[model samples]
Target: MGTGWKLYYTNDEYIDERSGRCPSTDEFMYYKRLDLCFNLNSPMTINFPVIKTFCSHMSAELIRIDSSDKQQFIEFITANETIERICIQGTDKIFPPNWTFDDGTLMTFFNEDEASAEPDGGKGNIEMYTGYKWHDISDVTLHPCLPICEII
Candidate 1:
């Protein structure tokens, strides 16, 4: 069997050979001061902002966060320097937590089959059809209508 790794943080002492659990703000500060981070373990339980801040500073590409914490994750990506990609998985949609940011670009990924065409009038201005009903691309396939703009 393969060994499991973990990132730990607690407010008290870290016992045994298991990953160190940060229990206090001071201990977390120590992690933040490190230049390089190496992980050899799973199931890291961190309950402090400092540790999370350190993880963000270490260029961790894959991070798992609580669905309810999506906004915080978004904030971290925008403010922190170490992260390159933030993937939100195990969900049915991209904006499930319903986070929004103005004056910044957000890339939303979807399956090719799930893509739908917009009306000619709505070209260059695409709004997600959350409140209104939308038909599939087939609805306009037979009409030879050229969209107002092309998205390349």
Candidate 2:
């Protein structure tokens, strides 16, 4: 809610100008250079279902940060006041702990803080929150965070 908290795309006109089509969902911003649409909702404690539904409706997937570009992306998101934590598309569902991006990008990058003991090998999906750190949390656990959606 501060000046630092800003949504890049505000209206259908802007979206049309940038991306040719207006997104069905209003809570997204279209990044011209990345050619990606991102949604960073208000700061609140929300569950996976809510985040999933929003991304599904927007025809987008959760944002995935590449390890090669982690620092740059972290700085970008953290600069926004309303976004402290965000739900990305990584989970430990598969054996041998395979983490992947929702958009099918190669999961070649990972930036887990060793101090946090991340990828805790816990049940459920992964969340990038708190000091831009990765944490494994249950899908149903309620936590204060924001959903980052990427146009699929």
Candidate 3:
């Protein structure tokens, strides 16, 4: 439990996040020591709220990479795949910004996009792109991103 990645308990088995082993599930695949189950449901989003609603309807939540291990796991999964970028849970919409996980865990993990200084202005949401580095863009931005979600 000291790994710090969020976990889930059920009639399912929990696998170590680093092992790259995931418990059996539906279309959503699990990853990391968090046993975080991810679903690439393909829901389009013009903003984070849209992604939030889509996840809520699925009884899941937006993807939140809270650790380097989780981030690397994501990169591993995306390697050789055709995904250009995926929207993740992170936003500076608030005065202080909240990159919190759905479980209300504050995000302490960071991987800059390096193309531009993130949060370029005052507000924006986060995205995982090239080399799986994190990028921040305006909330109003519209791009055909691979819709990704996490099931608790």
Candidate 4:
């Protein structure tokens, strides 16, 4: 027989059974400066389509770094999770080399090291490298990227 322990999802309408109040998860963190609640879930194989679906289920979306401030914030988020890479919101699938967010917004900011010839064309999805630079990665090896979500 299977173990009878209960489990909770990161997006669940969480309530502490003991205190009867919502409690933050070990992976939860929020910043009032940006008013963004972050979920630093452990790394897992991630792709845009599936991630989009999951975000909708949680009323969230993959993080988007559209400015220097946001780029720094994302860096902070990754540091807290100690992850090497995390999925972000951008894609060149529709227009190679020109990335856009899912909402059809033009991605005005970039943290990629242009000198490195980064964005080597990996399935058109964007990710944040440990160095805080942008890179296009394909989930070919089941890229173990973090699920960095921002609640709306």
lDDT (10s digit) by residue, model 1, range 107-135 = 24322223444222221112212222122
RMSD of 3: 9.7
List all candidate RMSDs to the true structure.
Answer: 18.8, 7.6, 9.7, 9.4
User: Candidate 2, overall lDDT?
Assistant: 0.64
- Model 2 bad stretches (over 4 Å): 1-17, 21-27, 102-106
Q: Count the backbone clashes (under 3 Å) in each candidate.
A: 11, 0, 2, 0
- Those runs of model 4 whose alpha carbons end farther than 4 Å from true positions after fitting are 1-29, 120-122
Q: In terms of lDDT, which candidate is strongest?
A: 4
Alpha-carbon error at 96 in model 4, in Å? 3.8
What is the lDDT for 125 in model 1?
A: 19
Q: On a 0 to 1 TM-score scale, where does candidate 1 land against the true structure?
A: 0.18
lDDT of 4 by residue, 38-145 (tens): 565667776667876666665678877778977887776567675677788888776666788877778888888586767667477788774878888764346668
The estimated TM-scores of all candidates read 0.18, 0.72, 0.70, 0.72
Model 3 residue 21 distance off true place after TM-score fit, in angstroms: 16
- Return the TM-score for candidate 2, rounded to 2 decimals: 0.72
The whole-model C-alpha lDDT of candidate 1 against the native structure comes to 0.25
The worst-scoring run of ten residues by lDDT in candidate 4 lies at: 14-23
Overall lDDT per candidate, in order of appearance: 0.25, 0.64, 0.66, 0.68
TM-score of 3: 0.70
How would you encode candidate 2's per-residue C-alpha lDDT over 47-126 as one tens digit per residue? 77677777777776666776555445545756756655777777666543666554334467666867988867656577
- In candidate 3, stretches whose alpha carbon ends up further than 4 angstroms from where it belongs are 1-26, 43-45, 95-104, 119-121
